[model samples]
Target: MHNGKPVVLVVEDSPIIRMGAVDLVLLAGYEALEARDADEAIRILESRADIDLVFTDVQMPGTMDGLKLSHYIRDRWPPVKLIVASGNAILEESSLPAGSRFFPKPYNDHSILDAMARMLAS
Candidate 1:
């Protein structure tokens, strides 16, 4: 934790989207980490144990998509909270890993922040 705040890792291939996420995370008083794709995100996860949550975007340019990354995290790092977002993909609630949440693209900032707060509080 950076300065006693929760750490949130954002994995998104698009620079624009990632920047937006980072802004929101910072505004919400969390430490933010950025990864361009699932592979980079995995490396960060492997190297850092301080991350309290992960916010990832689907349809990244990598071998593993956000769904697979979520599953991998659930299996390998069950303590980490997950928030998955997608613009084009239609995902069922059952498809997400246990304890994970989903947001459609152009997500509401308030809702996302509320969800993160709830997840971290739990």
Candidate 2:
């Protein structure tokens, strides 16, 4: 379903952060869906098979955090790309998939957009 401009999902409980991510995706010409938490994100992904990328905040106010969500996405949808952003900047790179990315919170908008472009291109 992803020819060029693929759908992106932004899953973050923070309203500001989710809006920022959604704005970046929209500005980049990719369709985006925003969810307030991991549960909502999971429901949306379950229904929307066209979603090509997932942007999740690592610290969510729920039983399943971004790491768990990433694992679930990789297990269920191997083709979907995952990007995790958080204040936990010291995450081990080896724990994530080769192309999967992790960014620290308060990331510059341009940097995140650039990373998104790189991910989508690949």
Candidate 3:
């Protein structure tokens, strides 16, 4: 956590989407960090321990996509929460890491915020 607020790292290859996600994070009263792809997201995760959550895009131009990244995080950092999104694919809940959440692209902002709040509270 940062300054008593949850720290959220948003990973998206699209600048506009990333910015919107970051804004949503800030709007929800969390500190926001950003990465363009899973690789960068992993780097940030490696460099920080205070991050409470990760918000990631599925399809990205990196060695690993958000799905892989989510599983990796679940394995390497079990305490970190995860939210995965995609415009191109819809995944089954069992496909994601246990305890992680997923949303299709064009997700509802309120729903995202609500999910974040609940996840962090837990």
Best-matching candidate per TM-score: 3
Q: Which is better, 1 or 2, measured by lDDT?
A: 1
Local distance difference test, each candidate = 0.95, 0.86, 0.96
lDDT of 1 by residue, 1-122 (tens): 76899999999999999999999999999999999999999999999999999999988898999999999999999999999999999789899999999999989999999999999999
Q: Which wins on lDDT, candidate 2 or candidate 3?
A: 3
Give model 3's clash tally. 0
**Number of the predicted model whose lDDT against the real structure is largest:** 3
- Worst-scoring 10-residue span by lDDT in model 2: 89-98
- 1 versus 2: better TM-score goes to: 1
**Candidate 1 runs further than 4 Å off:** none
Clashing pairs in 3: none
How many steric clashes does model 1 contain?
0
* Worst window of 10 by summed lDDT in candidate 3: 37-46
lDDT of 1 at 118: 100
